[model samples]
Target: MLVAGCSHFAGRRPLLGYSDKGVQHADTAIVACAEQLQYVCGITGVNQISTWEKFNGGKTPWVRVLPGRQVIRMTLSNSRQLNRQDVIIDNVQAGHVYRIDVGSSGTLLTATYTDLGKLDSYTIHMPRFPLEPKAITASF
Candidate 1:
């Protein structure tokens, strides 16, 4: 396969002498980079969070892009309210995955992920979508 042969022809020549392997790698990488951009281009701000405090009588959390409902949930004893939102701006360009969790109270939030290659489709359910609430409010 040309992909397998890429490194074998690495650094073969200058502009006057370019390897077909170099061209193939460049094209492949470009397309891959574009596809990756599409994934996040649709995700931003609170829309980045899968849960917010506006629903379920402010109890249950919301999940997106995942099947199977969460019938029950619990918070650990050590868990605490965030008090402020954790803003995360991530680029998965180098095969990295980012998890952004916005707690139901809208105060507690987290962002994390498994190894990029190891992450799965459903597990990576975080979609390129709009923010929750769509608006922020503060009582005067």
Candidate 2:
């Protein structure tokens, strides 16, 4: 497991998408999720981030991604339960900024994202705290 705060160089905010080689800032877009309701967990084309980074109170408000079509997966939680969601953003432009918004009605959790201009968005919803096989195994 990758622990949060593993290195002094790895600051509280983590950079997602792209590597240490040949990255052009002009061609990259940033996606942010400011609400504590959402915790970004995976990017479709990238490796899964450490769970500690996702759930251990580590702040992941924003992430960098190559401008294009991409899927962002995250978890939404309330006091009683947690749910997972995915937002697919298409036609993301270079140097643009986006944000994910999380909301809930009772046990139904919803996540959505829109560009800075509020022109486009994608959303997903799921029931809070659906049974997970891993949870059962872990409890044993």
Candidate 3:
């Protein structure tokens, strides 16, 4: 199992009780990020993920993965910002591949599997903007 706590900044400086407000904001962000991560993992058929928050003069969010889990959690700090994060699993076994796409702001994720039920190379097509799509070939 894996568990991690989110970032927290406190006790640095207190200006008219603003530190408390800051802590609240940070806690909200951490919870939101954890929820997003769980949603993405769930889309990938991973159902043994959970997250919670701990407050002790600061805020920290933790994620827990159950036993025999093969999932990764992805957390985004700010949903208002537009960014791209991609991961390619190379040398994957010849079988059905899973893809999970999660985030706000209309982000898209694509995964392709080829050469199933045959002894041949598998080709994956992934779009990169309006230009030509990116091709990834894997042999087994």
TM-score for each candidate, following the candidate numbering: 0.23, 0.59, 0.24
Candidate 2 lDDT by residue in tens digits, 24-103: 55566766664343443322232243222444344334566776777766666666657767778888786666777777
Candidate 3 residues 11-91, lDDT tens each?
A: 111111112333332121100112233232211111233221222111212211122223333333342442333223233
Ranking by lDDT: 2, 3, 1
lDDT of 2 at 109: 71
From the highest TM-score down, the ranking of the candidates is 2, 3, 1
Task: Please list the residue runs of candidate 3 whose C-alpha ends up more than 4 Å from where it truly belongs after superposition.
Answer: 1-68, 75-79, 82-94, 103-122, 126-131
Stronger candidate by TM-score (1 vs 2): 2
Evaluate all candidate structures by whole-model CA lDDT and list the values in order: 0.23, 0.51, 0.26
lDDT of 3 at 139: 37
Off by over 4 Å in 1: 1-44, 47-53, 56-80, 93-96, 100-115, 118-120, 124-140
Error in Å for residue 29 of model 3? 33
Clashing pairs in 3: none
Question: Which has the greatest lDDT?
Answer: 2
